[model samples]
Target: MTEHATRHTPPEGPPGDGDVLLVTDLSRRFGDLIAVDGVSFRVGRGETYGLLGPNGAGKTTTISMVAGLIEADAGTVTVKGHRMGPARVEPKRHIGLVPQELAIYPELTARENLTFFGRLQGMSGTTLASRVEDVLDVIGLSDRAKDPTKEFSGGMKRRLNIGIGLLHEPELLILDEPTVGVDPQSRNSILESVESLSTAGMAVLYTTHYMEEAERLCDRIGIIDSGLLQAEGTRDELIRLTGDVDHIRLDGSGDTVAAEAALLALPAVEQVDRERHTLHLAVHDAPTAIAEIVTEATSAGMRLNDVQITRPNLESVFLRLTGKALRD
Candidate 1:
């Protein structure tokens, strides 16, 4: 895959302007299963944070608690410094959630749906009408505002789902897999919309299993697995967890065991493993280590088919920490 430019950049220091939300020791359970265990993090105003992990990793559950969809079994959830619970309407009004499932009505027009949600938040009259139009224009669906949502494409429906959340002008917006099951064009449009919103000073909590999306959009990411937070940092910071190792993939034929032993014996080699006919090696330096491995393999009568050296990335760090591939 060809590389693309990234928009995410790590902050120089702690996010200090104003914390929009703070979660402390968040925990949740369902019978014998611990869905979320002591997951704690903070989101600053206008900052875009991400929760990334494999399927069934409790990312959804943690966000659900934060959105007040479900009560946590333990720990505290505060939004804009106000504790979250069923009793706090003021805090709830400041947050908006766009769930993975489309929450728009099929029979209602896009404009009608926005008006309904806006009214529920106690907005009405010319103010509500103006806000609805503003959101439609921002989502690039102003021309379709009067059309019934049943006739809209999958992408259009997804955009309306996001528009409904923005009607309230929320202090924080939580998106749970908002781009799933959409076309590439729609996905790109949605990402651009999110970027524009963040630039307008909106705090966003994005949850997705897609690494490239997180790498492109998030300022910092927190990776979770089976209810436990495994790592939390910017993309570069997390990649640094792999140390100075550079990944090298080679395909060749020799005594696999002997080849692994020879590679490990090299001074710069940190770790080596074999799968099928391929050898995966992690080394401190790319040029010198590649030279040593190639020379040793040639001496062992092995014919290398292909060799590629790659820098440490989020995927490699995930594998090193979890002992399994992210897709596994």
Candidate 2:
């Protein structure tokens, strides 16, 4: 786990006026197992915050508490200045959750599904009709709005489910891996929709184990593992915690021993590992170090076939903090 001091301290009273969701020292237990322990974070308007972790990482449980699906054993969730809970109508009204599982009725058309959910939210007449049309267009389902959901692919259905959540025009949108099991096109569409929503100033709480997704979608990320928030920050901020190094791969034919010796002499090169024809160098600043690295390798009698620099990314940060790959 990352150091605790770096974590944000919970505010003295309610969420700040600018914050949409404030989770403080949230803890949960299922019998003897502690699913979420003292996990806390805040989401601001127009900001997308991501919770990333492996399976059984308490991500769902944490979101469940935040969504008021289940009461937390301890801690508080403040949404738009109101405490959150299953029975808390006002706060719940501000939340829109797009669950991992499809919640739309397959028999209903896309527009019909949005309308039905809107009605359930107490909307009607032109207001409901206009919102439904807007959601269909946002989800890119306007052309097929009249088609029965049963005729839709898994991706289309997923998009419809998202449209249903969006229908209410909630201030806070919680998406629990909304793209899982969808086709590539649908996934991209969903991601694009999320980007637009954020740009339009909706607060989004997203949970996913996909490193690329977190990097691309989230304004900030909270890495959860074994129920605890292991780390939290922007992608670059977290990567800096892993000693801020870059990896360079040299693939070619030559005496590996001389190449390793030469790279070790460079000020930026910190470590070198040889794997057959490849020499992997852990160094600082690839862009500034590459030319020198290439020249030094050739001078040491290493014929470079290909030189590739792998920058530190969320995947590397995940490995450094959690002691496991993002997928693992």
Q: TM-score of each candidate?
A: 0.77, 0.85
Q: Tens digits of per-residue lDDT for model 2 on 1-328? A: 5563345354456567779999999999999999998888999999999999888899999999999999999999999989999888889889999998999888888888898889988899999999999888878799999999999989889988898988988999999989889888889989999999999999999999888899999999998888888878898777776677889999999887898999999999999999998999998888899999999999999998998898998887878777789888
On lDDT, the candidate that comes out on top is 2
For candidate 2, the TM-score is: 0.85
Error of 2 at 131 (Å): 1.4
Give the poorly placed runs of model 1, Cα more than 4 Å off. 1-17, 247-309
Residue range 1-328, candidate 1, lDDT tens digits: 0011011222234334588878877899999999998777888887888998788889899989999988999988788878887666877988998998889999999999999999999999999999999999988889999999999999999999999988898989999999999999999998988777777888889988888888888887887777777777788777764464688888988676678778888888888888977889987767767888888866766678899998776777667666667767
Give model 2's clash tally.
0
Give stretches of model 2 more than 4 Å off: 1-14, 251-280, 287-305
Candidates' RMSD to native: 7.5, 3.3
